[model samples]
Target: MADVATTVAPLVRRLLGGALPVRLEAWDGSHAGPDVPRGAEALIDDAAAETGHLTIVVRSPDALRRMLFAPGELGMARAYVAGDIDIDGDIFALLDLRHRLGAAGDHVRVGPSLTDIGAVVGILRRLGALGRPLPAPEEEQRRRGRRHSRRRDASAVRHHYDVGNDFYDLVLGPALTYSCAYWGDGVDDLETAQRAKHELVCRKLGLAEGMRVLDVGCGWGSFVIHAARHHGVDAVGITLSPEQADGARARVAEAGLEDRVEIRLQDYRDVTDPPFDAVASVGMFEHVGAAEADTYAAAMAALLVPGGRLLNHAISRPDPHADAGIHARSFIGRYVFPDSALHEVGQVVSALQGAGLEVRDLESLREHYARTLRAWVANLQGDWARAQRLVGPGRARTWRLYMAGSAVAFEAHRISVHQVLAVRPHADGTSAFPATREWLARPLVADGTGGAVGG
Candidate 1:
C-alpha cells in the first residue's frame, strides 16, 4: 500500500502541473506519498490544493459524496457555509474553480439528478440558510458609518460585471446579454432563448421603423442595437457605468448602426427625453431602492408618449416577506449592491398604475432566470483568475455569494424575475392594441422553430 501511494503521488503532481504540490497518505501508515511529511495527517481523496501561497485543502470528494449521494449545488454551498471545507487564499477563486469543474458535463451528470427527492431536500435545507437573519454588524464605527450611502455601488457593480470582456464573451454567446434569458420553456440552448427574449421585448413595445426608443440601464446596449438593427427603430441607451457606455458605443459603431443608436453614461432620473414611442428598463429595477421605485416608474411614464409602451424586466420577490428574515436587504445594501431593493410584482403594478401607466402584460420569468444564473456561474468559474484580477478578492467573493445565493433563492421559489409590459394611455383613455399580432407573428426563434421559452 505504501508503494502504491508513493507511485500515485507523482501522477497527481503531474496532473495539476508542477506549480501545485500534493501530499497523499492512506488511512493506514502502510502507504504515503514522499511529500507527506511525518506526523502530517491524510486528507480525503476529494480534496484539492487551492491557495497559491499555501497548500490549502479542498474537500471536493467529500462534497461530491454529499451531492451525489445526497444534495448537489445546495449541498456544496452548505459545506462552504458550515466551514466543512477550508479555502485559504481567495474564497471566490475556490468557488469559481468548483463551479467550473462541477458544471462540466460529466461532473454535472455525476450528481444526483434534480429529480432525486433526497437531493431536492438537501438543496432545500441548504437554501434554508438564506432565510436566516444576517449577522449583526461589527461594533466598529467605521463599518456602521460606511453603510449610510451609495459609496459601494460602483465597486459592487464593477466587482460582478467588470470581469474581463473575454470571460463574459465565453459564456454569453454572441448577444452578450448578462440578464435573464427568456427561454420559451422548450428551448434547448441559451443563445436561442436569449434572442427570443430580445425579440419579445421589441414586440411588446410595438416597435416600428423610424420610431424612437429608450433603454434605461442598458448593459452593453444589446437591446439598443437590437431595436435599431432588427426593429428599424432609432434607439438611445442610458447606463451609469462608464465601461458599459463605452463598450456599447464601440459595439454600435461596429454594427454600423452608430447613426441610429446612441449610448450615454447617465442616471435614469436625469433622462429628460420628452416622449419616446417605447421605453424599456431591463435588469436594472433592483438598483432602484424602495424609496426610488415611484421615481423610477414616474421617469419611465414621463419619457413615453401617451400611447407608448414600456417594458420593465426585473428581479422580484413573490411577496414582501419572501426575504423577511434573510437580512437580504442589509447584505445587499452593504456588501453587494448599495441602495438596491427588489420589489414584489404587486408593488411594481401599484407603482406603475399610480404613475398612470396601465398594465398590458405580465410574465413570470423565474425559471429563465434560474437557468441564466446557472450559466453565468459556470462561465465565471471557467475564468476565475481573470475574474479575480478584474475585481479584488473581497469583491469577487461577494459576487459569488450573491450569485449563488440568488440561484438558490430562485430555485427554492423564494425570488423571481418578471417582465411587465405597460402602456401609457392615450388622451382619450384608450389602448392601441391594433396590429399587435403582426408584430407578434415575426419568428421569435432564428431557426423558424417557435419552441423557445419566455414570451
Candidate 2:
C-alpha cells in the first residue's frame, strides 16, 4: 500500500501541476511528513499542493478507499457530506478534479460494449428487490413541504445557481446566460445561440423603447440590463437571493443602466404593481414549488397589462415518474435545491391557460440544455479550486453530482427544457405581435469561425 501511494502521489501531483505533501501509512507502518492520526489503518495523501491554504485535515486512506469505490454517485457524495474524506483546501477544486478525472475516461474505463454491460448492472442494482421501498404518499407530500420555508428555498436555489460564477463564466461563453441555447439554422456556437435566444425573447414580446418590463426570477439580471441598455426598455428584475440582487445592481450601475433597470431582492408574490407591457421569467420556473404553480402564474398575470406577453424559459420533466428512484428529489431537496419542482409540458400549458394566458409559441430545448450542461461541467472542472473556497466541500460535491446527473438525464431523454411564449389576450382577442419569426430568423452578425468578433 505504501509503495502504491508513493508511486501514485507523484503522478497525481504532476497532474495537478504542483508538489503535494502526503503521508502514507499502513497497518503496521508509518511514513511521516504530516502526522497520520493514530489507529488510522491505511493513510494515503491525496491532498493537492494548491490546497495548503485551507485548514482542513486529511482523511485516512481507508476512508478514501471506501468513498472512491462507492457503489453510486450518491454514496460518493454522501462520503463528503459525512466528512469521511477531508479536503483541507478548496472543496470546489477537489470536486473539479474529481469530475474531470471521472469524465476523462480514466477513473472507471470500459470499452463501449463493456460499458453497456456495467450500465445494465447498475440499473438492475437500483431496481433490485432489496432496494428501499418507494416513498409513502404522506412522505411524498412532506417532500414538497412549502415554498415559503426559508430553509427549503435556500437549499433549492443555492444547490444549483450558487456553484460559483467563475466556474459558470468559463463554460457559458461570453454572454453568461445559463439557460438553453437557441440552435436555429446557422447557429453553431454557444455565444451566438445564447445571444439569439435573448434576442428571440425580446422580439417575441415586441420590446420597445420606454416599455416597462418585469423579469421574474431574473438570474444575474442579464435580461433586464441587456434589454434596458441595448433595446431601450425600462426593466425591473426580481430575485430571491440577496447576493444575486447586489451583484446585478453593481452590474447595472457599471453599464450606466440605473436609469433603465432596477433589480430588487424580493419574492414574486411581493410584486404587486400592475400593467407592465411585457414580462419574462427565464430559467426560474422550476423553483416554484408544485403547489405554488397557480400562484406563480397568477402573479405574472396580475403584473401584466391587459394584453401583455410573457416569455418563460424552464426545464421540464417528461413526467412526474421520471424522477422516481433516482434520489433526485431527495438530493435536490436536501443538499442542492429545496422547494423546487419540475413540471411536465402539459402542466405548464395547463397553468398558463388557467391563468387566462394564451400560449403563442412553444419550443423544445432538450438538446440545447444537454449541450449547455456539458459546457458548464467543463468550465466547472477548469476552475474548481476557487469555487470550493466560495462554497464548501459538501456543496461542491453536490453541484458536481447534480450537473453531471442532469447532463446524463438530458442525454437519456428523461428530462428537457423549454421556451414558452404566451400572451394575455387583448380586449379584442388579437395579438399585437406582427409576425415575430422574420426578426427571429434575421442574422445578427456573420458566423465568425475565422476567429473574428461578430456584432
Instruction: Find the candidate with the highest TM-score and give its number.
Output: 2
Residue ranges of candidate 2 with Cα displaced over 4 Å: 1-76, 80-174, 183-189, 320-329, 444-455
What are the per-residue Cα lDDT tens digits for candidate 2 across 1-455?
23333323333343334333444332233233235443333232445344344323324333333223333343344444545434444433333444323332111111112223343344334323123322221111123445456555654565466555655565465677767766667766777777667766787777878899998888777778767765789999988776677777888898889988999877777787768999999988878766778888888878888778999888887775443122342444445555566788778888988998888888888987877776666666567686566666556555655676566667656678888888988778776655556656565443444211122
Q: How does model 2 score by TM-score?
A: 0.67
**Inter-residue clash pairs, candidate 2:** 92-384, 92-388, 93-384, 93-385, 155-337, 156-337, 156-338, 159-336
lDDT of 1 by residue, 313-344 (tens): 98887776443122332334444454556788
The residue pairs in collision within model 1 are 2-31, 46-61, 183-453, 183-454, 184-452, 184-453, 184-454, 185-453
Q: Which candidate leads the pack in lDDT?
A: 1
* C-alpha RMSD of each candidate structure in angstroms: 11.9, 11.2
Q: What lDDT score is found at residue 235 in candidate 2? A: 91
Residue 442, model 1: Cα distance from true site in angstroms: 5.1
